[model samples]
Target chain A: MAYQRKRICRFCEAGVQYIDYRDEKRVSRFLTERGKIIPRRVSGTCAKHQRMLSSAIKRARILSLLPFVSDNPA
Target chain B: MSELRNYEVTFIAEPNFDDERVNSLVGKYTEFIEKNGGTVEKVERMGKKRLAYAIEKRQYGYYIYTEVKMPGEAVAPLKRWFALSEDVFRHLAVRMTDRDVRLKAVTTEHYRKEMDRRNAATRPGAREGGFREGGREFREGGRPERRDD
Candidate 1:
């Protein structure tokens, strides 16, 4: 039997009203180590919040709070 | 100026600047803003930190954040001032709305959340390791392949 856990939107689950650009630590969780944002399908974030999250993450990267591209090990 | 609006300016300063020099620059900007009918609300110096990517072969940078109440047009001049400074490598001044102020509080809220997570992490039988920040293991493309064993 292949039973998978249901995916839920983190922001909706946590009651997070606003996504802040300066909160790098929290924002980093949504990003892959290579500094790429995880798609909403993979991350289970709603489309509306995903748009806001991506924009904020980009701003955070510009401010050096987040990396633009993580170093590749390969 | 019709009325003052809230604004936040953040910048990455050259790492070579000493505390004294950085303070002086902050003071100069504060004074300039005040002279322009803007009131500086607060300042935060995030100190030196490693850059995610090297800039001009420099691996580190100094971060500064300032919040002020000023006319909307004043931000352009402030940005120009930032550009003129040889020590400031990158800068941005964004007009802050009420929603932004509310969101800024969310940033601080995350700090509390982070601390709580750390505390829980250190508890007995908790994992000693942390998430790999390098993203070296992450694959960018599609979903996992399903295969019957």
Candidate 2:
């Protein structure tokens, strides 16, 4: 049998009960350089936390904490 | 009358608002909440912050976050007030559930512990041959290795 490592949800591991939209710094890490939300498969986020994260990102965008689209790719 | 509920209201004002102006603005909203059968619980002036994108061609905005307790009926009128007010550039009101309240109360200690655990786990050659650091190196070249074997 081949050995495989399990991926744990970072949010769950961190005991994050609420993902605050105001926390743009932490949320931005889950986004690609182009400002698109990274999918769960790529980011290893659980389904529930991914839903919360996406909504939080959307809310942050509305509040101008996160950009809807990046002007510069960098 | 409906029972009072917790709501979080956040608004952005023009970046040029001075401390005095911001305080007066907070006072104004506090009175507004009281008049609308609500009580203001907390107010935070987040100061001027650079916007992620231009809003009204402005690069910055002053943020105000407030927690209020009010009946559901009062929300509509408050939103209307925001819409009509020249001072408010943008506003959002979110109703808070018990879950939200519980989550908000989670302390920083939990986060610190998690970070420490992750740091320890990620130490060089700790486990799995430190695959995470190498994983990114592989990703930069091409898609990450996905084979289980």
| Candidate 1, position B114, lDDT | 51
Candidate 2 interface RMSD (Å): 1.3
Q: Best lDDT goes to which candidate?
A: 2
**lDDT (tens digit, per residue) of candidate 2 on A1-74:** 56545577888866687887888898899988889999887778899899989988998999999889997975
Chain A of candidate 2 gets a TM-score of: 0.87
Q: Which tens-of-lDDT digit does each residue in B1-149 have in candidate 2?
A: 67999998999998999998888888889999999899999988888999988998999999999999999999999999888888888988988897887786683556676466446545643455766664444342363433433
Query: Model 1, range B41-131, lDDT digits (tens) per residue?
Result: 9999988988767777888999898889998878778888887988888886777789878866885686577566445434422343433
For each candidate in turn, the TM-score is: 0.76, 0.79
- Give DockQ per model, in order: 0.27, 0.47
Q: Report lDDT (Cα) of residue B106, candidate 1.
A: 84
- Residue-level lDDT of model 1, residues A1-74, one tens digit each, is 57666578888766576787776877889998788999997888998789879988988888877888888721
lDDT agreement with native, every candidate: 0.78, 0.83
Segments in model 1 whose C-alpha atoms lie over 4 Å from true places:
A1-6, B106-149
